[model samples]
Target: MNTVDALVQLSFQVQRILAEAGAEHDLSIVQLRLLGILRDRQPGMLELGQHLGLDKSSITGLVSRAEKRGLVERSPSPHDGRGVLVALTPAGRRLVEVGEAQINRRITELTKRLNATQRKQFTQLASVLVNT
Candidate 1:
């Protein structure tokens, strides 16, 4: 297979793993992404929307649903009174941790076809692509 084709197939395989892991916790891929983003930084709605590639209304709806599920909360931004930041709740953090473990396990399984050296090289190459 060509490099593009191989990369596309690998993307699908990884996405499938992520979907399966997120499904175990009743999260859609987008929701999982939201929680994952919140696991580190608390961003205002505008920034969050940009990160998620969502518009204002769409982001609002997503946040609302997560809030209802006790997974995320909105707080007044310390820097901007008019702006609200979305953050992961304790429940959200716990869910992200569990879901991450499952995803890691599944992804490790997928990489088992590679030898240890190949796996290390692949990780380095993939990181370059991601970071670039």
Candidate 2:
């Protein structure tokens, strides 16, 4: 395959691994992403939507579902009373931790055929691609 096709296939494989990891916690990939983003900082709905590349309505629905699962909470944004902030609950934090571990394990397995030098080269190449 060409470089673009190879990259696309790799992306899909990575996404599938993440989806499986999320499923173990009864979370959709989007919900897992929400928890991942909220793990670090409590961002308002608008900011969350922007970071997730979701529209406001989509963000609302995603957050609502996560809220129902007790993985996240919505509260009045401290910076803007009219807006709402999305934060990971303790349960969400724990789930994300486990999900991340699973993902890491799965990805590592995918690279098991590579030697240490190839793995380091791959990591550096991926970092450059991501940063650029």
Instruction: State TM-scores per candidate.
Output: 0.95, 0.90
**Whose lDDT is greatest here?**
1
Which regions of candidate 1 deviate over 4 angstroms? none
lDDT of 2: 0.90
List the candidate 2 regions with Cα displacement exceeding 4 Å.
none
TM-score, candidate 1, is 0.95
Model 2 pairs in collision: none
Per-residue accuracy of model 1 over 60-113 as CA lDDT, tens digit each: 999999999999999999998799999999999999899988888899999999
Alpha carbon lDDT of residue 108, candidate 1?
A: 92
Candidate 1 clash pair list? none
Strongest candidate by TM-score: 1
**Per-prediction CA RMSD (Å):** 1.0, 1.5
lDDT of each: 0.93, 0.90
> Model 1, residue 29: what's the lDDT?
95
State residue 38's C-alpha deviation in candidate 2, in Å.
1.4
Predicted candidate 2 versus true structure: per-residue lDDT over 72-123, tens digit per residue: 9988876776988888889888888888889989999988999999999999
